[model samples]
Target chain A: MKEENVIEAEELTKAFGDFKAVNAISFEVKKGEIFGFLGANGAGKTTAIKMLIGISKPSSGQATVAGFDVYTQRESIKKNIGYMSQKFALYDDLTVKENITFFGGIYGLSRAKIKEKREQLISELGLEDISNKLVGSLPLGWKQKLSFSVSLLHDPKIVFLDEPTGGVDPITRRQFWEMIYKAADRGTTIFVTTHYMDEAEYCDRVSIMVEGKIEALDTPKKLKEQFKVDSMNDVFLKLARE
Target chain B: MSITLNHISKSYKKLKAVQDISFNVEPGELFGLIGPDGAGKTTIFRIITTLLIPDAGTASVAGFDVIKDYQAIRNTVGYMPGRFSLYQDLTVEENLTFFATIFGTTIAENYDLIEDIYVQIEPFKDRRAGKLSGGMKQKLALCCALIHKPKVLFLDEPTSGVDPVSRKEFWEMLKRLQQKGITILVSTPYMDEAALCDRIALIQDGKILEIDAPEAIVNKFPKKIYNVGADNMYKLIRTLQGYEHLYSVFPFGEFVHYTDKRDSFEAADLKSYLKNAGLTDISIEATQPNIEDAFMELAK
Candidate 1:
């Protein structure tokens, strides 16, 4: 059986005047796979992600995400994907349940469905007692979990998470990965970006972006073996220094 | 001791920000306070630098009492906070000169101290600090912090949002600074960075869990850990979590970190069990514990 490619990009190029933020990159993401996009601070990882998510048009390239054309069918692409950016995009002043309800409404979920999901999310995170508490009062870990759950409210075909576990504790980070695993098990594709090399190991496969080009892409083990590095951090250092 | 703390505790209203934590740093040593956000690492830094008054206990930097000799301590220590605090609208050169002037020193007077880092950002001297990239901003802030050449330096979460290459460069700069005989106390949420420190104190919830060299800390994890993987990682984690003898099962990078409560355990037994459970491509191997594994054990 052949695996489906949920995302496909060929010769993807995004240029800002003479500077190429993303230069002729090409890759495919298998359906239900967790694909890691790794890079340094200004390495154009964000630019590539924006193009795939249909927010930013590529200067020259051809791509399809969830079977929708990136150049023309962006509105359809937007409907089939969920995104959790680095900044927690939740309303801090709103109560937990209210925030969930508001986001669910934006996704056009039914009123009854939103109510059910709100309860399920609150209980799943062990927040049953404080469902009415303002999101600002919750701990950082709890807020992060809530933000992730809300991103999944509409159950889009794919989820794009940008540094979802930054500044979180080990325990919380561990638990967050567990959630990601469960979601993947249920057949949702995950596309994530992170600075933590350790987290890179969790992905099914990872691609290293250096200075707007794909430097390496393979299973973590293969990349480590090919680079002859013990860890992903060392592999990253070796490539990024070039 | 370059830095000392005795039963330091701080509370904001009812929440205990720091709880009776104590540690010491030797002169010219590179020490790390490793933990996540809200772990009370910053509170300790602020307390030692004489920026905040602890509700109880005493601290000193460079032999000066934190409470009584705050002015002297301030003159002898440099602090780079987690967030960038430079004048964003000003040019890089202007910001550097302003910070140097306030510290009663000129950039030319301390040229040697910041020469390595300043040279990297010198081309952008005329660019506004706000317009600089993340790595460039970090370098500028570091240079300004060292302009006066303080004996001890405190950096809070310096590499949190930085990229791999820049992070490597920053650590290299820290090594050069340490070689110059300046005591450094750095706090980071990254466990791998702990190995670069001479010694580290693992902090959580405003308390020190353990303090030792990075290798020593990893050696302290008593349980045997195995790196386990299968064709279906999601199913692998779920199945392993249900295993009766498991002590902990969490997803690591490529493998699931598995530990059993019972000391009497064998890989063959678990391997056959997974095979029977309809899992293929199983790879299980005993692995040495790392600082993060040790931290999870200590934090428990």
Candidate 2:
């Protein structure tokens, strides 16, 4: 069981002055699972993520990512994970192909490998016509989809998406999720956070954080059943409002 | 009508931010400009608020011409931009007071108007605007926008990144304000929030796809939707995308909202196809279409 778990955290905590942003949360994520990490705006989701991805040191606890200890192997953990935020994605001035090449270079891909992946990615996303267009000029949805694919240029063990579909259309949001489904199918773990509850229902397992602690973590079905609700929205409200 | 646009259009060089768009927002009604980013929702809001002139067409707010009476329109509209525009250095109370004083009003004058929302953040009045949480900043922004007591309120993507709990609270505040006869022209990308509006204009690519009451919009969806699920979502989507009779295959929560090109669709055919694809735990049920379903169909 331990070997099968890609991420395992026990009593992981982060504190600032007297406040514990992440209150000794414990969880394990299996390989190839779509795990939804959800919370209110200041519920410490970002704090926990920072710790899990090995950017921040834990106040006290034990954690491992892709089988590397967080405190001692921060660089190793970073190498095994891919992170993308909604606010900052690809370079705006760079063209679509340039952004891919730049990120691929950052990920340490060989020139030949980058060229090969560029062709596959461009064709897969149907970006042949706009391959030379600046990424900033692409439509909002297209930019987001392209950003997600670029994040996977390194093919890390797990991809962390922070509110990946913030302000896109209904179809575009679903389309981004389809990309997630495809990646998960390819045996890469997807650890994502989103505000949209409908997206939560798509997660294999969801963990909702309140204030500084995870109030509930389970399959969306069981969480709804336990909260006496039919939807993830109600379950979140029940937890956050408490 | 409280607001009207007569074939309004705007362009930024070669880009058509808004096409020949025309719509009427009735008095005291909570009308929503429902669309995603770059759908020209902000452009429409700007034209009505008199911040920007339309390339072509005429629009009026509160019976005042947007071009001729731009000053009067400015006095009667409270605009909360999609981005948080309050002064980050100012404390919450100072920002509120500054907005009130500039508008020739005071927080005391409109205390009743914003008491419900203000009280939540009143405790954080001493904090700088930049120090507040995402939800708190939104509440403060709302309070500032409402301070002048404008006849028409325009909120642009008020809940873009706020969590679900805060989003619900914000909508409730809007409903309360509507009871006071303030016409709200709010824009959002969230399709679920569309159901809460009195009426919504489904805009995309700088064009209105549909305009009607929320239920009416959902009712207008032409296709019958079905919820199809199996052991594997990715495989399920792949299989459905390959189906010869597929019209649209979207991933809804726990199922793919499947539609068919043929009117007389058979679930048995889809189920057998999935079974043959080496998938199990399949479940298919007929479902009603919602605003999202309608938007996808129209935008398709």
Error of 1 at B128 (Å): 1.5
Q: How well does candidate 2 score on lDDT at residue B69?
A: 100
DockQ class, candidate 1: medium
Per-candidate local distance difference test:
0.91, 0.93
**C-alpha lDDT of residue B124 in model 1:** 94
> Which has the greatest lDDT?
2
TM-score of chain B of 1: 0.98
After superposing candidate 2, which stretches have Cα over 4 Å from the reference?
A1-3
Sorted into a CAPRI-style docking class, model 2 comes out as high
In model 2 chain A, the worst 10-residue window by lDDT is A1-10
Instruction: List the pairs of residues colliding in candidate 2.
Output: none
Q: Global CA lDDT of candidate 1, please?
A: 0.91
- How many steric clashes does model 1 contain? 2
Provide the lowest-lDDT 10-residue window in model 1 chain B: B160-169
